[model samples]
Target: MGNYKWHPRFLNPPRYRKENSQLNIHLWNIMKARVSTNVEKVYERLRVIVS
Candidate 1:
């Protein structure tokens, strides 16, 4: 692979951000499903990011 730097901050966190409301609702539904399971820690982290 090329010398691509992995930037975790560039990645989208898993949360329902009101600011990104312009995005597709269907995409949000899928995100909600991904974060709705036994991923409490990740969810909390994402919530912080959203806030």
Candidate 2:
């Protein structure tokens, strides 16, 4: 996700932007769930991202 969102990488525009603080904070929250090492929590994060 980070790779494609960066310069000279994606073939299309990123769905969200780092310049937008909301998106940055959202991404941070999603990534934070990884530390818990639980599939259910990760799925919940994906749900948050999608909706």
Candidate 3:
């Protein structure tokens, strides 16, 4: 969680201000996709266990 807060600075960096928007969007999308996939996997596992 704390690492997520510092992600903007780490991803943006001071050397590449021009590419920040696209880079940030791409990284954020990847992270969101991973999170959703993990959530679905967990939900499926729980459902199997419950049944």
Candidate 4:
């Protein structure tokens, strides 16, 4: 087995800012579609978990 070095800062780094922004945009689009279709339960559950 290989030894692994764990760095606290690297473990949960905020280095994916760009990717996160794109993902938020995609999530907004999905939420909008679900709201328009009156299927908000799924989005509500996700919001609870995210918040």
Every model's TM-score: 0.29, 0.33, 0.65, 0.41
State model 1's lDDT: 0.62
Shift in Å, residue 3, candidate 4: 38
- Higher-lDDT candidate of 2 and 4: 4
Clash count in backbone of candidate 4: 0
Write the residue-wise lDDT of candidate 4 on 2-51 in tens digits: 33324554335567687775875687689788787776677788899999
The lDDT per prediction is 0.62, 0.66, 0.82, 0.67
**How many residue pairs clash (N, CA or C atoms closer than 3 angstroms) in each of the candidate models, in the order given?**
0, 0, 0, 0
Q: Could you tell me how far off, in angstroms, the CA of residue 10 lies in candidate 1 after the best superposition?
A: 16
Residues 1-51 of candidate 3 have per-residue lDDT tens digits of: 668756766766667666676877788899999999999999999999999
Error of 4 at 42 (Å): 17
Candidate with the greatest TM-score versus the true structure: 3
Off by over 4 Å in 3: 1-18
Off by over 4 Å in 2: 1-19, 38-51
Writing each residue's lDDT as its tens digit, candidate 1 over 18-38 gives: 656446456768888777764
TM-score of 3: 0.65
Error of 1 at 7 (Å): 18
